[model samples]
Target: MADFTYVSTWRGFVYVAFIIDVFAGYIVGWRVSSSMETTFVLDALEQALWARQPSGTVHHSDKGSQYVSLAYTQRLKEAGLLASTGSTGDSYDNAMAESINGLYKAEVIHRKSWKNRTEVELATLTWVDWYNNRRLLERLGHIPPAEAEKLIMLPSETMIWQPEFTDKTLSRKPGAVQTGFTRHAVSWGVCHPNIYYFHNLTPGWVSFNGEKPEIAIVPQSLHRLIYGPDKRSSPSLDDDLVVNLCTSEHLLVHHPMLEGILLSECERLKQHSLANKLISLFRQFGGTELRLKLVWLCWLDLMTGNSLDDWTKNLKHKSEKDLEQWIIARQGQSEPLTNLMDQYVLMAYRTSVDAAHS
Candidate 1:
């Protein structure tokens, strides 16, 4: 929930906005502004986004003018957040926010009279750090919110995201709206539809799927568009192509043209900054499948096109056609062969994640 409270500073009344995560009772984002405006809340929301990167969370706030403004709502929609407002004119509807405001009033605002917005801002900066990392909350088993969040951090796949709409269960929180979230409890951020679709599919996997006459069109769109498809990839069929079919059912479908198309797409990605996308995929995927990820790394090498140097140092540079014959033989392997191969893929992924963060 987000709301602004006025602090009695010497110059005048300065407003401070708070965006709290109801789960841990953690203040994920906040801003101390000289005036109450939409940007006051928006900047704090952005801070929470940069910090938490949550997906499918609901943001509840009162029907204050700033919260209802177009800019605020549009920003929520852009972040894939669901927006819910408490019924108008009822202070009890946003009881959680009201309680926090009371806490703030007692803790800092009433304790000392700030000389200016600068003093309040600085104090808030110190207070927020303390609140997240140290201050104990009775609701969270008397431990600090940050510590509580650490306890709640479930595995990514098993983490249960909030429902799409508001209901009585959410209302119990009484104004637990989220403009910003803490990543400790929920970490999913929006990924591009195309990247999520194409990142896991190898050319060999696509080839095997393409051999099925009914499924051939799916591979074409996933491959380099230069090869073309009878029907292009769209939202409806992307999930069906990936999840519905069992890998064990397919014979590694081969096409003389597939290797060329995948080469073109891989090289195209490597030439542009989009090649960095594979690194983004690294954090989410458990690890590479079989040696296909290895093949992909080889494909990315401009000097040694399709050479299995890292995985098989014995064989020097290998041509695309030679690599093709080798890949055809290994598609049936159920599991990745060596732990060393997984380490290599994981090492590359970690480097990517670290570089991007730095």
Candidate 2:
């Protein structure tokens, strides 16, 4: 909330506008001017913007002509601030700002007589510095606003470990195929028993009805455009074609694409709520690029025909038991594999909860 009060002196009356943070009661921005122009409020707001570089901040003020003017409203919008007005003649609406105004009047204006506006301005500069950095208020636990801010902005501690679901409950079996497609399905609960539309289809998974008819995996729009007139039969249904369905469908759906398919895929994956946890984990471990890298890795894994047995062949210990042990050992470790593992674990927990409710 913000408000400006007048300082009377022998020279003239100086209007001082202040933008106060409601929560901390800190004077974030202030501007002293000779007249009460719309710029009077805008200058203070500008100062606050430069100091905080805030986004989605609310600037609440009274319905003064200065605040309601087009220039002032435009400035607020440009700075990404939400401009709010209190009801006219209602003290309670702007009580926080009013309270600060009252304190300023009592502490500065009434304390001593000033010769000119210059003296009042100078005195205000000194007083504001002391108020924000040195003044201790009972409301702030007798600590200065600067100190309170430091405490509030400090980083929080890391999360402690907690296991919410077991392997059996999540329907994850020991030594089961741990392909990229399976990981994605388990993590997101996207591969349902009924609704089997996939962003990417892999080995050993059938369509919803299991008819296995030749499916033309095209964009819904293209399907409409082609069949609306031709009434043509879908193209030959083959495993290779079915395997490419997801990526092909994505390209068809997002027609007239200007950029790479990988970017689109990455964005689409992130939109899923379950995928968010995986994205966050990647961000924490690796930098920003890791999020996109992990997505591409999943795509690459999906493209590969290699089975777990094949992958385990050249390992230091090559037995089936050795491969399973190695897989378990690497759980929650690093990128790509770690994200995939986390996804499966989460999916298992979700499945258990859904089953219980159903």
Candidate 3:
């Protein structure tokens, strides 16, 4: 005995319905939508039938227009799946589906905000994957749906062993350049700088310079190849060159390999310079605006310096708090400071949400 579940996300609104098997808490079907369309419910029912392939499984949902639509009823008859609709305004009739919906909102939707249809779609996909594969359902004896399915399929096989392997190798070419470099890397040192030129050497199977010539030896397999490093131990010349060439703006705009190493070094020095400037400005009776601007600039520098999506989201969160605290803690904080902070907080929150949804 199994049940089918249909859930819809209508412009951020979600509706979940299920038909239960009294004997077994098996979920046979589910659907999702961003609208209160009959198609959504129908799709879910169709999917459930596909899942169970049970010749006369009862499909049940609330008395929504979508469920009562001619097309929906026709489809159910065509498939030979029994259709059952709950009585009007009877909460108990659709309790199971409502419970599933409540769980979905509490566990997934309420935790974050979605920006658009695409974002909602992606989030729904992730939620479904988690629910079906990772979630521990108490009804299923605290096992994931997929795991439970496996157990049923291979009851005699007590232990399902999955072999895993790891390859410690970089996925990309050793020295691949970032795309869109021309638009953003004009002031950067290695916009189009040749790695061969940086090394001041002709392409060949040789290690012409270093403390240990043999140790620094260029592997024949790697030499003369555009994206190859001499060996795993040797620095990736192209990536290194890009790092050395990166200015602050360049680093902010381009996602180059080794950018993190270069930006970290740049930031260490920039932080000292900024500290000195701030101290000097404070001594010189700088206005609040100037101090605030400098603070934001430093925050932006740190955010862009990291160049990773997760780090940027974290920086956004920290910056929002930092600005608020800076204004409150500072002695001469102005009214305009509050407005400025509001603008940044909103923007950061939006960006963070977008990044998460993305």
Candidate 4:
């Protein structure tokens, strides 16, 4: 959903409009203006349209006058986009957009002072670049939004976070980011044994998460670790075969056999600063083996129920336009967003399990 927030500057108050791609939480389009005119929202929409060239994309927003204007509606219709507005007095209806607005406020507007529209615009441009390209998001598996979209299934140079075994464990390297855990998360580029297994099995390279060319661990390996090496067709290896994190040293060490641990951890620790860091390292095992494609499905389901058909079966190849319609339908639903998100994750887990077995 799209919404504009007011920014205070020496020149006056400028409004900022943002159109976010709910899939990876990327701000696809944005505009900063001194006025809350329809043109402001329209310009943002035009930029998004031009960048994505999307057809049947849903544009959801609050019942603001600018969003409901004739000019905006006409533009959406002409571009083959659908417009959806929340009901009166319902903040949760446009919760996702509002959440973005809240983040922009906390991270940029509230933290820094602005001189004029030019300054705000420049800052926003920089922030968007950082947010999409470098910022690690827990929802997207501790990867940036752009990296999620440009996913290389078999990454040539993949970085793994080697967890410190205990507080007494000597540091092999300096920590990149402080995650407030007992053990500081360290990133390493060395080839782990799991990488070699995939390299040998698939040969050249394959999409572990179905995002071609990017190296990611498929559910089969996760199954081997979570269940047992002999549980599947793969040859039995030591306990360290997969990036097993559920040992006595980690937070989730007790819940080794947990299903949907990734999604559950998200709901459990959504507000924790160190949540993403912990999750990215821990989700490699159990039934919650995280992947970008499955996370994208959770995003779609979070936005709206039944927006995309369950890919566990026949309708696995739905188009983008159909996905957009699902978002529009979701905005109009009376059901809770959390329930929908859970349902989608469940469906994704089942589908992934089936795919791994096949």
Score each candidate by Cα lDDT.
0.48, 0.49, 0.41, 0.49
Ten contiguous residues minimizing lDDT sum, candidate 4: 182-191
Least accurate 10 contiguous residues by lDDT in model 1: 247-256
> How do the predictions measure up, each by TM-score?
0.44, 0.45, 0.37, 0.45
Determine the C-alpha RMSD for candidate 4 after optimal superposition of all C-alphas: 16.2
lDDT (10s digit) by residue, model 2, range 291-358: 33334333332222222222223332344455345545543344545554345344322212111111
lDDT of 4 by residue, 184-229 (tens): 1001101112222211110011121233232112223222322333
Residue-pair clashes per candidate, as listed?
A: 5, 2, 16, 10
RMSD of each candidate? 18.5, 21.8, 22.2, 16.2
lDDT of 1 by residue, 1-358 (tens): 6677888889998888888876667888889888787888899889888877865465767778888788888888788665666557755445566777788888777887789999999888888888788888775667898887775564322322221222333222211121122121121111112222233222212311113212211231223332333223222222333222111100011101222223333332332232233222322232223233533443333212233233334223444455445544443342332332344345333211111111
Ranking by lDDT: 2, 4, 1, 3
lDDT of 1: 0.48
Better of 3 and 4 by TM-score: 4
Candidate 2 weakest lDDT stretch, 10 residues: 157-166
Name the lDDT value of residue 36 in candidate 3: 61
Score candidate 1 by TM-score against the native: 0.44
Q: Of the pair 3 and 4, which is ahead by lDDT? A: 4
